[model samples]
Target: MLKDVFVVAATSFVALPALAQTCAFTMECYETEACQDTSFALTAELDDSKLVTDFGDLTVVGVKRDAPLITVFATGEGAEYLLSRNGDTARFTAHSNDGPTAITYLGTCEGEF
Candidate 1:
């Protein structure tokens, strides 16, 4: 009986739910500056608290994630941009800052995570 109990406990421990799960998303950003008129697209893959971006309109150089937020760093010529997003949803939103200029992106991301 003790052996059976130990086996059951071991199985139960293995069946425990994960504390955290990774999220992979593909997002397209259309309309800039938090609902303005300039179309763009940017996608990112998030794992725990890290993100890697696939460049579309902006060349992603580096990425960092803090909880539900993600920031992707990029640059081109004399322009530098800081891009960021929050959460994982189809209705995706992102923000970018280049010196005195700031831009926002809105679109759909491919994920149910």
Candidate 2:
């Protein structure tokens, strides 16, 4: 019985890598919310749960699954953001330094997580 359970568990873990995916998000900054002015294309590592942008690499702090929408929360040195995706379309928002300024990111995803 123990051997059978181990085999099943090992088989399940083997399939995890196949579920890992990477997504590219576009930064859409508002007039007042200037995220370095030119930093775009934030890469999301779905399997690794990491987001890479002009703020550098940020590890996902939490995740929320709301049916069609899946959201990941991440924080940087002075900024925090959430990336939420429904199918191919995704929306992202970030606030830094605890100020009122916030930046929004919008784009389409290519793979599944």
Candidate 3:
């Protein structure tokens, strides 16, 4: 009985880290110009509190657990972005620092890490 209990405890401990999973996403947005479109990729490391992408590294600041939304900020660029996940699809929106230059991203989940 003691051996079984220990095994269960060990399994739970190992699985605990997997509960905080990382997600990979591919995002695309259209530029201000009518014919321009930009594509990018990003990864959300929930356990590490980071959003990694080609643009720059963003620090995850807030999360809405009930709705599965993440708010991240980049200090160097003074940018704030919201990543909202709905099942297999996700929407990302970046707010402009100055004015009128915000971008919207539509993407799908690549997988979890």
Candidate 4:
């Protein structure tokens, strides 16, 4: 009976789904040198739980732009990011499993080029 109970508990725990949260965010990339003017936009659906849950300092990994380096802030999942660009429009990848996908919390901006 104890073994059976343990097995049932384990099964139930495995059946539990991962926590999910969602939000909409956008980041615009600027020029490589001056970075004064706007160049492109990157938008993503972020999972709130996985991101910087605490309002602490967001750790920025790296940034790239225009097939090279650009000044921009990104905060979201580490999963495969599907990027779609048209002229100057930006869009994010849509997941079929869940909505409001997890996101890494990118910080805000207050500086000029």
Model 4 lDDT tens row, 1-113: 99999999888867544432222234432222221222222222222212232233233343335632133333434433333333333333322224434322222322111
lDDT of 3 by residue, 8-85 (tens): 988886745432333444445545644334566777776777777788878877677554443434332756788776
For residue 25, give model 3's deviation from the true position in Å: 7.4
Candidate 2 residues 1-113, lDDT tens each? 99999999888866545443345555576646554433356677756778866658988888888889988899878888888889888777887776666777677666666
lDDT (Cα) of model 1: 0.46
Error of 4 at 108 (Å): 8.7
Scored against the true structure, residue 102 in model 2 reaches a CA lDDT of 77
What value does the lDDT take at residue 2 in candidate 3?
Answer: 100
Q: Count clashing pairs, candidate 2.
A: 0
- Candidate 1 lDDT over 38-77, as tens digits, reads 4444444333322233443445577666867655566644
List lDDT for all candidates, in order: 0.46, 0.73, 0.63, 0.33
* Global CA lDDT computed for model 2: 0.73
Give the TM-score comparing model 3 with the true structure, all chains together: 0.65
TM-score of each: 0.38, 0.69, 0.65, 0.21
Best by lDDT: 2
Ranking by lDDT: 2, 3, 1, 4
| Candidate 4 Cα errors over 4 Å, as ranges | 1-14, 21-23, 32-113
Q: Please identify model 2 stretches exceeding 4 Å from their true place.
A: 1-15, 31-39
